[model samples]
Target: MRAFIAAICLFLLCGNAVANSVQDSTTPADAIVKALYDNLSAAYLCRDIVDADKYLKTRSVVEATMLAFTNKQDASETILKKWEDEIQINLKYQNQNISVEECNTLLRARTHQLYVAMDTLFK
Candidate 1:
């Protein structure tokens, strides 16, 4: 939650002009690709999401997408922070008990979903 809030704060701090520019060049496909990349990565210190090698091409796609977003570093940091908060929230809901095993299960499920999404996208 804090990470996501921080990302939003940073984005706002960066100025509206940059945000507008980013939005103008960013497509829905680019956003989808970024979301998949974010979900597949352990952006947060929460847990590891495996099966990344299965979709190696996703990295390239995500890299290209990030470049399209104006500033790559800013976009990467912002998205990572957002994913950190998102993963934490998902872990809570997906595993109310919050067990390590449950976390592993959740991450695996998320990774698999992202992989499938990537396959569909890249194909």
Candidate 2:
């Protein structure tokens, strides 16, 4: 019984440490952006406009909410708002202007921005 309890505790601690390390390595923003891009890409590949629209709506909502909470200063807040608007507009366009190539490019940039923003906010 004692050995079993000790093993369980050890496993839990190691699991928690690994989870925390992974979370620390990637910001929530990065994960969101990556998921958005991935979903959009898969939708486009499937020629499924409905799924793409769903992802776009989800992305807009998440970005707007996150920016509202994470950015308080006027200057950056304005910038974040502008970005949120851009994302919304992108969704409204008939084309959506989201080709696989474009999505790939956007994903790269957003990933970097996510890390930077997270560092600034957390620090």
Candidate with top TM-score is 1
**lDDT of all the models against the reference?**
0.44, 0.41
Q: Judged by lDDT against the true structure, how good is candidate 1?
A: 0.44
Model 1 per-residue lDDT tens digits across residues 1-123: 455345434443343211112353243343344355444343232333333353344444444544544345667656545544555566432324355565566556656655565455456
lDDT score at residue 79, model 1, on the 0-100 scale: 59
lDDT of 1 at 99: 53
Supply the global lDDT for candidate 2.
0.41
Q: Which pairs of residues have clashing backbones in candidate 2?
A: none
Residue 48 displacement (Å), model 2:
7.2
lDDT of 1 at 51: 39
- Tens-digit per-residue lDDT, 1-123, candidate 2: 455334433332232212112343254444433343333333333233344564455455434534444443453344334544443455443366466665555545544544555454445
Q: How many backbone clashes does candidate 1 have?
A: 0
Error of 1 at 94 (Å): 11
lDDT of 2 at 68: 47
lDDT of 1 at 43: 25
